[model samples]
Target: MKNTTDKQLLRRATAVHRDMLKQAEKFGVSASQYDVTKLLHTSESGKVKVLIDATERLAIAIAKRRRIIICEK
Candidate 1:
């Protein structure tokens, strides 16, 4: 079995972190408000599914950015 360790990424020197946060906030609002509201009128299941998918997509976007930073370093 391989050992699991937490490798930390430093963020102090990253540019556009604030901008990314703003974009993430906007994504959260869109997922929580617009997407859910549009589907909620039809089915609860659809709302939940969309919410989960949006969360995953948001996480992936953030992860991609972090990977880019790590690679840069």
Candidate 2:
């Protein structure tokens, strides 16, 4: 049997991943504002950094939720 704590963490991770996907779609809606030509000239590092930040935020949110679950348990 899977440990309750492990199962809880898995569920939390899945939920956060879904939320991140929704957030990504929301962010994609604003892509029309960028000039493709100018964007092509911009460094990829900037885009990578933004993705990293979003990922980090999602991770932090998941960790916080997990902590809450542990406290409740």
Candidate 3:
């Protein structure tokens, strides 16, 4: 049961990450080049922040599953 839920979460996160990349490309920038904080509108910034946070959390979860340590400075 837990494994199934994790798989679903992983799928969702992958989809979101792909979509974000596509959006950045539409703006003539790669996902790594896109700056979420530079958005002029507060709401848009907040929404992007939430998505980024979720994606980070998902990455951490995946790393843990593989017994990998993610060091943050």
Candidate 4:
């Protein structure tokens, strides 16, 4: 169960994260560059694996200066 405050915090965190990502992109940094800046240096193994996969794609986009769209079916 989630409360209104919890939902608000989640929205705020997401907005901040998005801004950070945009700044990273503007500065020509890959999303992986901010991975080390995560609140904790650790995450669940499965989540970490997902992050690693997304980071790889972000690295490629940064290297090529092209956008990559990930799709979920």
Question: Whose TM-score is greatest here?
Answer: 4
Across 1-73, the per-residue lDDT of candidate 4 in tens digits comes to: 1567655654554455556567557747666554533643454233334444445555555545534322221
Residue 47 error for model 1, in Å?
1.0
lDDT of 3 at 47: 50
> Any idea what lDDT model 4 has?
0.50
Off by over 4 Å in 2: 1-45
Write one digit per residue (lDDT tens) for candidate 2, span 18-50: 566555454442222221223423553344334
Order of candidates by lDDT, top first? Answer: 4, 3, 2, 1
lDDT of candidate 1 over 1-73, digit per residue (tens): 1222211111221123334445656544332332233443565233444544554565577666667767989
Which residue pairs show backbone clashes in model 3? Answer: none
Answer with 1 or 3, whichever has the higher lDDT. 3
**lDDT top scorer:** 4
Candidate 4 runs further than 4 Å off = 32-73
Worst 10 residues of 2 by lDDT: 29-38
Q: Is candidate 2 or candidate 3 better by TM-score?
A: 3
**lDDT score at residue 41, model 2, on the 0-100 scale:** 38
Models, CA RMSD each: 13.6, 14.4, 14.4, 12.0
Native-to-model Cα distance after best TM-score fit, residue 57 in candidate 1, in Å? 1.0
Counted clashes in each candidate structure: 0, 0, 0, 0
Candidate 2 has an lDDT of 0.47
